[model samples]
Target chain A: MSSDKNNINLKLKVWRQKNSQTEGAFETLDAKNVSPDASFLEMLDAVNEDLIKKDKEPIVFDHDCREGICGSCGFMINGEAHGPQKGTTVCQLHMRHFNDGEELVLEPWRATAFPVIKDLMCDRSALDRIIRAGGYISVNTGNAQDANNIPIPKPDADEAFMSATCIGCGACVASCKNASAALFTSAKITHLALLPQGRVEQDQRALDMVAQMDAEGFGACTTTGACSAACPKEISLINIAKMNREYLRASVLKKEELSGGGDG
Target chain B: MLNFLKSTVGRKYIMGITGLVWMGFILGHMAGNMLIFLGPEAFNSYGHSIVSNKILLYGTEIALILAIIGHVTSAISLTLENRAAKGTRYAVMPKGEKASTWASRNMGAQGSAILAFIILHLITFKYGAHYETTVNGVVMRDLHKLVLEVFMKPGYVAWYVVCLLLLLFHLSHGAHSVFQSFGILERKMQAPLKKIAWAYAAVVAGGFLSQPIYVFLVNR
Candidate 1:
């Protein structure tokens, strides 16, 4: 572990709110000197401790795994989402990237659907709702097939992985002035639908997910590409274009019967 | 208008229009206020006349408020459509950093900053002692005196300068954005549009900043 000698002090202007119903405002705090090697979450932990020591409510934010694998922890750093580091998750971000005495403004993701649950914590479950609408493939439970039963080309698999890497963090939604999620949804749809196995329920998946995404009251994508820039996972706007194509295909084909006539 | 509102790009066009309209308002307001540095009596009467004309001022205020709300709503609606269009996600997105302006991407943030400043300014000056106040039977709105009281404060001048900076950035991107959203901006028009946007931004931003600098330095 790196020593604390390299740590720098920071001032944080964090937005605090009790819930979605209440109005929130920025509250400034002095972050004590801390290690530059500490993960972003660890730095938050340090700040939270100070708040607790003063008997004030610790800032409420979300984080599942500090390892950057779970796609939970996300908040604005200064004006940039996930800090100034490109292609880096918040939890993986280290203090060394920031200058000493800099004023960091932290806020929950700004989107209509993802309202602030509290300080730094936003209700991003709207994304999960969108996924649940039609993000899955229809497969049988009892089938144990050989790996050779389904042949996936290396390039296709790589593409699938590329699209599948979307953590669904809502950074795309947050960064967008319009708060659109087409990139995130299309990424999931294209990742699976591109493969032979996914083709079975591709049409249904596109229709259902897009319908749900709309019902969630999320805004439309204007192809501004801000979402991609702010995304911690760097999900591409190409996925959004793919989703548009898929939605058009599904809408036009109007196929009533899903593969195997089973609900996904 | 209804037909235009029905389409995808149409709604964005509306947003761009409303946004540009608000930007126009900002430019006009800044230009009008900068006359304060011309000397207290000159700036004072202008402020007084504006306040006295309840019909014009209130009408403009209502329109400004509506434009702001429309811009915000359109922005929200467009974002949702973009998200819904993406079927799945990719690890690499298009290179957005180099393509769009800083103001375009940070519209929401900039809007928030501007809104906060407006509220502060309204409370501190517009509705405060700077305006025509009543003491007994006397109508006491000293326009020149109010100008000095507000701008002579280094803090207020500094804050005004910051607001103008935000306005400048907003106009620079917003001017071109309106035309693009309308689909009126073609490859042939790009060069001219770029020049126009820069000039527009410079005039508005420069005009507004001139007020504070004049007051803080010359007037003081």
Candidate 2:
């Protein structure tokens, strides 16, 4: 809609917070003379430059590898996780997608598991802890195996690849009404469970990761499909179904087969 | 298994299993209620057959009661935990996926209301005034008379109307949610599964809904 305009000047209502310990509020600011081709984060950078020139503390947000691969740089833009564009991260969103003079509301992910570290920046370490608890396969170190060694089926490989694409951006958590980390946890579970190398510890992996996810105070999965719909990677809801199946296996698994956890 | 049930995923399995059980009961009950349109003979006979076999009737009753208990306990536990998990509400969070938020988001309120309705429903119908009737030289509960009498009251019909609506609202999400909880809802099956859930919910709830209005209006 803004293709006709060389630049779009917009109003921004950004969430400002000192830290998780304190209260947060919305701070209204203006972004003027912005190029339509500029990414969403670039517009923020421009606004930050202006704030610096005015001797004010600029807005704090998380971002790395502006290429959209770093699993960083995500905040709610008008309640839509990673902005309104489907399957595109905020870092990849251009200003042209938004109308000129539109009011852009920016806030960090809202969840007990993702506490605010600062303005538009939340601590997503809970996701890391889920991985640490057991998001791994039993791979021996040293020599690399050829990709064709496993002789995996094409569909399985494709599904595994899709599940592996989850960037851990917390968009799923932000989008879910319950703020359940089911999508994030399930994606890792699916990615690891599908491959042969990870199959050995699959039961324990599901158990530990899901237990850790619950321990993090994240909500339960209602299977509303919101997380999958809002996912930037388009992670399928099947991962969650797979996660459920894996957990079912854990319940039936004998004590000898279960090694407790994948903490090692 | 105890440790597994303690986990969120395990609790959901409980929710799913009980949910399906309720679905089956709802289907059978709604179908049997349709005999009301077939007159007292058919309705009374069906009721007679149900209570005639003490073991079967009591078994079904116990099973249904257990399903309700399982469904309620797990739902309450999950809801409380979910509430606490969302530490704070967002100042500007807009509604996401309208189709989802409507039923899924309101499941707690709707479920609680439905539970209350179930309690009152049992008292009114199961333990309602016992009227006797003889058909084919066999004594039976005049449930048809009780049904007709209750529906004739405007307030009772209105209550049924309201409760049926809540049932539909709750069923819309729940019908589909069962598949997800059981790990059966694959990507290819998502659309069909959702459609089946809606159709099933509508049929069961709608079937129950038609009775009160029919009884009240037809008799009047």
Candidate 3:
């Protein structure tokens, strides 16, 4: 729909909430004569600037680096996570994607684990808690080891690198019909489990992270596959399968250890 | 070990394993059902042979019952937890963004239909009239006559066909998903598994559906 026109006038329907306790609703406003080259966040900034000029509270949303690298900013644009484009985060979405006079809808991630904090921002600390459960390695770090001290196979390293690319963005959870965090949780598990350095605690890491994920009140993954489809990093759903393998193995081993082979 | 059952992944693993058990049962059941094509002598003899072995028949029946219980319980709990996870609903839901199948989304509804069908089927066939038929000068339960009598009625035939169709939808999703849930299927195997699932669903449904249609055509 991009043409000779340099600017597109749009109608924005943004979700606004006072806090988690209060009810929320959509606030429709005019986004007039916006430059097509502006990023989606910049367009929101323009709208907020106008609200401020009219003696109204500017729209509140979470955004750190307007760049797509940081996982700080994410909200549903229309019905799709991070807007209509595939593998494009909201921060990287350009206004040129929309046509003139098109009505755009925006809302925060709607999951029990993520409660609304303000207008377009929701509390995503639930993800942080899952990571804290065991998303790290416990190696001693007095001094940096030589680069080639521990050899990693290319395939394992590649797969591990892919899994590690997860930005902790809540898009997978938002896009899933079940609001499942399986993709996010599995990404962490698979990333660590694949590396030699992270292998020492792989069993415990899978167990604790999955236990923490369930405790966080997230839903079970039914393999609907929307999470991987909507993932900005294109995180594979295979990771979830790998995570399941890890959890099952660790659980049986732990049970054997606990019962001292009596159960067997 | 009990704590594992409480976790979401663990519950799904149970569902997967139990679903596989059910699939195996369906395959065996379908194979046994094919004896109807061999006429009354073979069909009745097959029925006689199954009922004659009391321990093997009862043991298999008990195992099937346990599998059903496990599958149904995990399904109900998982569905409730999934609903709770989605705290709020979107005002406008746009469709066709993803490649999700119709069967995958409505698994609960399809499963409920299958459950209802199973109850009705058991009452109609297993506990139907106790008529006796002489095969090779030996009296046995007339299961072949019962099947012919049931299939002759248009209403019963329609119901059976409808149930088989529901089963097709259920198996179309269940077969592939069970392997994925158990974490055994690899990335490269997904496409082939999906194809195999569709083929299995078609074959099972087709085999079961042919009986009533064949009986109706011959008797009419």
Residues B24-87 of candidate 2 have per-residue lDDT tens digits of: 9999999999999999989999999999999989998898889989999999999999888877
Give me the displacement of residue A107 in model 3, in angstroms: 1.8
Poorly placed runs, candidate 2 (over 4 Å): A1-5, A254-264, B95-99
Give the per-residue Cα lDDT of candidate 3 at A255. 42
* lDDT tens per residue, model 1, B1-220: 3433533435666677788778778778878877676665556667667878999899989988898788878766664565554322222223435134677656666767777888887887777775555434546576556656777888888888887788777777777656645545433565687679879988988987786677668866
DockQ of each: 0.07, 0.70, 0.63
Give each candidate's interface RMSD in Å: 9.5, 1.7, 1.5
Per-residue lDDT of model 1, residues A141-184, tens digit only:
99688988888999788878988888888777766555666678
After superposing candidate 1, which stretches have Cα over 4 Å from the reference?
A1-4, A257-264, B1-220
Global fold similarity of model 1 (TM-score) = 0.58
Q: lDDT per prediction? A: 0.73, 0.88, 0.88
Off by over 4 Å in 3: A1-6, A255-264, B97-99
Which pairs of residues collide in candidate 3? none
Q: Which ten residues in a row have the lowest lDDT in candidate 2 chain A?
A: A254-263
- C-alpha lDDT (0 to 100) for residue B143 of candidate 3: 93
